[model samples]
Target chain A: MEPLINVAPYTGWVYPNETIFEWSVLIAVYPYLTGLVAGAFTVSSLYQVFGFERLKPVAHLALLTSLCFMFFVPLPLLLHLGHPERAFNATITPHWSSAMAMFGYFASFYVALLLLETWFAYRPFIVEKAQQRKDLLGTFYRILTLGSYDVSDKALRYDQKWILWLAIAGIPGAHGLHGYVGFVFGSIKAREWWSSDLMPVIFLFSAIISGVSLLAVIFVVSSKLRKIPIDLACLKGLAYTIWGFIMVALVLEGLEFANIVYKGREGVEMIMEYVTGPLLVPYFILQFAIGAILPFLWLSYMIWRGTTGRALIAGVTTCACLVLFSVFMMRWNVVIGGQEISKTGKGLLSYQMTLFGKEGALMAAALIIAPFLVLVVLTRLFPPWEDHAKSSSSLRSHA
Target chain B: MKKVSNPSLAARRSFLSKLARAAACTGALAGAGALGVGVAKGASAKTEAKPAAEGGSFPTKDYDWTKHQWAFGVDATKCIGCLRCVEACKVENDVPRNAHQFRTWVERYVYLEGEDRARIDSQQDPVNIAASGSEKEYRFANRYKDQKVDKAFFVPKLCNQCTHPACVQVCPVGATYKTEDGVVLIDHDYCIGCRYCVQACPYGARYFNEEHGVSDKCTWCYHRITKGMQPACVEACPVGARIFGDIKDKQSPVSLFIRNNRVQVLRPETGNAPNVFYVGIDKEVN
Candidate 1:
């Protein structure tokens, strides 16, 4: 992608007691996003693996979404690298122990898994297109098929079997993938808030919360775009999953704090400067109130009294809330809470957001904005929603 | 060999030495694929254990340096209600004269206004002592009880360039480093302007040099120290509150002072192992 020019850095300020370098938000954003992608992919695998017909519509869409976002996940960390060129060394000289180091292998396998699934899922369609003519599209499809363009029933059966198997296997891989992102922060013994093993569990749950919620909304939006009627069954089905995950996430969030406070770790009292202090507003108001509470209410209302349309709208709103709040608070908490206590454990520090040059803010902007741009491009080219039907019909009526 | 006459004891010593030698050789061979910096095994350890330069003098071994790198140390006990060191560091580092952003400071906890509601807070814009500014430039009588400073202690702060510097370890490109002489320095040239070092620093000493597009921290004055000079802040301290020198050298004033005084690193548990030692540090400090 040709990088966007003139993307300015957001206004970020330094706190008196904080470090001179602005690292928390910029560093945390990438992991937060990867968590979302991994969470969504895990949900997608459920339909593929367990034969939930309700989730069938999103089977291809989920794989494509996972593929699209995974491509961008490594870039933020890359730009953050002091030496971006030498980043490949992360793979070649893998520090297998460090969670950050294992990102290379996870990324490689995750991408391969997604790609293989996409190819197999879309193969019969491509093969059908290849049998038709001698144009560039035909050549492209033929190349995609690797000359085994025979549209045999047996080949389709085999592809379906493994795609289902791969999806099942990919579920745990995806969960582990995002869990590892949490492990990066949780493993660091230095920081107080991030150093809990429960963090990975919390992150995993939140990813499912955000990912599935976003998928519910996206499916509705896309169906409407193509003039397809809202799938009420799927909407209800997704809400049940969302409720399950959201409750899990809320408990996990509470458990994380309780674990810390209960243990009375040396750093716990200091970080309360966050729970009841600087982060109190963002934590309760935005993250809990809007992100978790409102969504749960709206979805619950729809589940109980309202129709599929209302449920879809509520789910969509919840996804927006969850996405924005989840990313915002994760960054805010990491950046703000990380700096609250003094290294000497003497007193509290403060922070005011500093927005200025492209060095910090613009780089982060490019990271987030660029992914949706890729998603848009992918939609234009492949159109994840229509792949199965279009390919099948074209192949059958090729007389 | 053993008791000056026992052959069995002599044989035992020889055999033990031979076993140790073999074990060390095997260990080195096992870790042959290991990479970078210091070697981990016996033959290499022997090569590394070069016996601290056998003669009267070599570069670092014989150098008398307690006078240079061991910068300002505060005696919280004998602070005498002074804030001169804080002012001195501000002037030296050219820190913006802000109420919040302090390079050095004094925190005052007072049971003022009423006895029931005790409160604690730091005073960044400390009032200077008007008259005999010698050692009493900072007086808090008006701010506390008896028109006198309340239960207060003036604890001066500065970046403790740690032994195992967290900031240095997390820097992606090795931008932050400790000098051979034991002072930490930030190299702006190789810094890609990433603030990982800044965030990782337990002391919060490292800061993004926004003006320079790179991270900067208390250098212990690399430009000055290398050429036999003291840091600006240490030089300007009026009350003899600041002492800059090498901790390694026994003869240096700092080494003697540290040995004589009950010096304490700010946050010993952070694992940074700060080189900065305060003689009379308080309980709660970051």
Candidate 2:
């Protein structure tokens, strides 16, 4: 068996127990998954709530993506927990003062909201599948329908209304959930790196960009898989969404960094040492320059040139992939970076991630991949595609 | 007014009765709270029934927690880096027998003749662990023995058990909480082992007990302190460097230590309002 604790190597003077990092890479994955949930929900809401017609093509995919990722959000946390069996203890007797105590409530409520909205958004598709087939797949759709088989114009209108309200409510539900994840770090007064009022806002904006970028990639990739011509208008809408949110994310992150430096709190010296030394590549080079700036500039160039057709699709897809990487790096920089700077105000510790263990790098990779695998199954069952959805709605109209 | 003989005796009796009544009320409340926590844990019913929840007024049946507000004091100037307190704490608390996990530990600070900063290392340091030659035992290595030492002192560190404890505040399940008498503790059975409290603590006093899958830290030896004895560390110290007492008694050793000297708590800016007081520690001791 592997050693239960992985002690980090350090420099300068850290507390004896500081050698063992409490939070690990799994903790970083928690916020990364939540940000994607919030971001994808944002895309669905753009069409459902604000009437972004150009975003209609990927809106159903957005809701499905959000739900799939939301289901897996708690897996990393459960795996990281020492007593996975007693995980519900937090919910049973939550300490009201703790920022973390609210996680169970927030996550549950958001999951319910996502499920309700996903059901309402796909109800038409489910009704059609339930009536059209008589196989095992048909039984699955029948169960998903929850016995509600109304396909009339009035019923469809009511469903649309419910979807709209759910999307409106989810705007705050999803974003608030992700922002609270930020509060979990920001409220920690011990670490100078995380104790900033701007942390939640920074996390909120980054969540928006990551979620939107995820939708852009999923939208482009699924279109190719179906051999369907990509919708330029919908892709542009996602690009614009990513472009808008990424700017805010970059600015908020910059200001958060500036606050840390300008305050020059007791631990700032070590933080400075960390950023210049071990943190230079992850924080600056990847999260900022290559991950963020390069994509931002690329999207801007494409938009300026009145880019269209295959060039636009390739450009946006590449940019979306970069933004996704950037957001993961952001979570890494926040969660792991906070731990790297010791609370001693005089030392730094480098976290050594192992290859195989309960909280190892391999498990982290598996978690990231698990959601996509679930999405593949979910998409097959629900078929959250634009042309299929349009035909189903039209079929309902003729009924 | 009615004529009364020996008025002072009557006044003293009245004061004693009020104190006793207050103590009884506080004890009742603490007992009820603990029972509530036990019932909550028992609701799950999967784990085999253990003894009455260890956290609530069960140990030392006659001990009254409400009457004592426990406090500790460290005279850093007097420490010899003997590592006795660290070993005693481990043996007494059954803390993990390893260099990385410590319930209580000591730090050695050395300021060379020309250096402005104090160099710091603890028994958990690889060099010192090597000197001890076993993970089960601990001792500070004499690494600085050959160098010309200018100024040096050993500062013994443990859980501060703060008045406004960050650890207790961040515990999601309230499995770890501040007792009425002032020591912060964890209910191993109830903790989800999320380790959030371990991160919130500024002093790095807390560690995850991997064996038990729960967060553990220096309780100031809650079991011993409640039984009217010195903590294991205090008893093990050869010199009078470690002090533990109830500050409620104005004449207790810890109370005197605070009154007779200028004292400081670690990381005062974190506003944890730590209960552990220190004397003869320099500015460099976070």
Candidate 3:
């Protein structure tokens, strides 16, 4: 039988209780999911509110992806709780001072906004299907229509207005949720790695890149699966989005690291040792070198050469995958990495990640994959395809 | 155009408006209900009477927490690295019988002949645990006996019970809280076990109690302290190294410890303003 707790081994003089790691791999997965939700919503809002016409092919798909990922955002957190049954206690009787107490309210509001926006965007499609088919699936669509089958030109215009405003409100609703996740870590004065004024902005930029990269990968994969011709312009638009945001993310991250090293506060020696020692591979090599810089340079080259067709598809998809991995590494470094350097300025504790437990790596992987699985089912049910978006021609016309 | 002039269309419009109004009314009622529940919970939590200290009650009889401002002090110069206080604390508090989880422990800082940094090792260090021969026992090893030590001293560490506790500030459900008489306590039943408080504590005093699924820390033995008795560690100290008393009395041990000596608290830079004072500890203690 396994022990109830996994005690981390330490080198120097860590506090005795610090041996047991509190936050696990599941905690890292939480922010990663929230970032993807915020990023995908950016793509949807770009088309609906900002009129980024070239991104039209993935606009509806983006909305659907955001909603699907948003659905599973709370699972990793809920699973990590010691008492999952009492999770509502934070929502019902919140402690106003805590940074974490506001999470319940922010997440609930964002989920509602995503639902409403997705409904308005799909109202035309739902009404059309409800009228054409009398099968069981049609019954599902008819109920989903909420009895407002008025698809007249005027009604369509009303729906368009609602969609535009909802997408606009969702801009802050999504990014605020992700930015707040950053504040939760940044505000803690305990860990030098997490405490910085630049933390929230860094998290925000990284979240944007991660979300956009996710949409790029999903758009290309789904297009290939459906045997549809990949839209070169839309793909280029995503590549450019990643290219722009990745630079900000990189700079913010670099500044955060530099501030830590330059400040050279009480625990700088231990941190320097940990980074150059145990953190060499995970932090420098995997996160910055391969995951971030390699993709960034590849995309820059592609853009410079005016790459198109199969070459663009291959280039952008690979870069998106790299960005996704890099962002996950960033979260891991911030969450687990902070804990690995003990609060006692004199020691280091290496987190022993397990394979099969509740807070294990396997569970973290499942939580990450669960969103895409839901997206597949949701796409099939709602048919957020570009060809089916004929009813809302205003959206396409803007494009 | 025909649909625009249809009379039934006007009727359908009225029905949809009614539907919208009805939905809005339900939403408003639900929101009010939620607020009502939240207010009620807050009120009950506030008004619940403290457990009286009567006849073997959990809190000692006639002990008023509001009237007493408790404080702790450590005189490291007097400590002998005996490990009795650590044993007494584990038994009294029922802390897990292991080398890792400690409510209070002793650190032996040794500076050998030519070292710039103090070689610090607590009783939880592996060699000491090996000397004790079991996780259930406590002892310090004699490994440093052969070394040419320039200086050495023992520092007993416990929760400082800061005036502005980072742990209490980060508890999402307000489960862990500061008491009126300067102590932090946890409501085990209410804690969601998110461990945010654990992460927020700079001193690393808080630890998750796996058995109870709640964060745990030294309360200065709140049950014993409220009963007008010393904390277990102070009572078990053989060298008069640990001191506990209410600063409300000017002549109390803790008050004199503060008034008579050049006392200091650990990590004053944290702005936590720790209630536990220390004397005879070096600059490298933190």
The candidates' DockQ values read 0.13, 0.34, 0.32
The CAPRI class of candidate 1 is incorrect
Candidate 3 i-RMS = 6.4
**Residue pairs in collision within model 3:** B53-B60, B53-B61
lDDT of 3 by residue, A27-123 (tens): 9999999999999999888888888888988888889899998898899999988898878667655666799988888998898888898898888
What lDDT does model 1 reach?
0.59
Q: Could you tally the backbone clashes for each prediction?
A: 29, 1, 2
Q: Quality of candidate 2's docking, in CAPRI categories?
A: acceptable
Using alpha carbons, what is the TM-score of model 2?
0.91
TM-score of 1: 0.72
**Chain B in candidate 2 has what TM-score?**
0.80
Q: Which lDDT tens digits does candidate 1 get at residues B236-280?
A: 666666677766567666777788888888768778788877876
What is the Å distance of residue B96 in model 2 from its true position?
Answer: 0.9
Best-to-worst lDDT order: 3, 2, 1
Please provide, for model 2 over B171-194, each residue's C-alpha lDDT reduced to its tens digit, 9 standing for 90 to 100. Answer: 887777666678887877667889
Task: Evaluate model 1 with DockQ and give the value.
Answer: 0.13
Q: Model 2 over residues A1-399: C-alpha lDDT tens digits?
A: 215566899999999888898899999999999999999999988887887878878888988899999989999999989899977656544666889887877888788888998888788889889999999989988999999999777888788778778889999999999999999999999989999898898899999999999999998888899998899999999999998888999999999999889988787888999999999999999999988999999999998998999999999999999999999999999999999998898999989898898799999999988999999999888888867777443322332
Q: Which whole-number lDDT from 0 to 100 does residue B179 have in model 3?
A: 67
Instruction: Score each candidate by Cα lDDT.
Output: 0.59, 0.84, 0.85
Q: How close is every model to the real structure, measured as TM-score? A: 0.72, 0.91, 0.93
- Top candidate on DockQ is 2
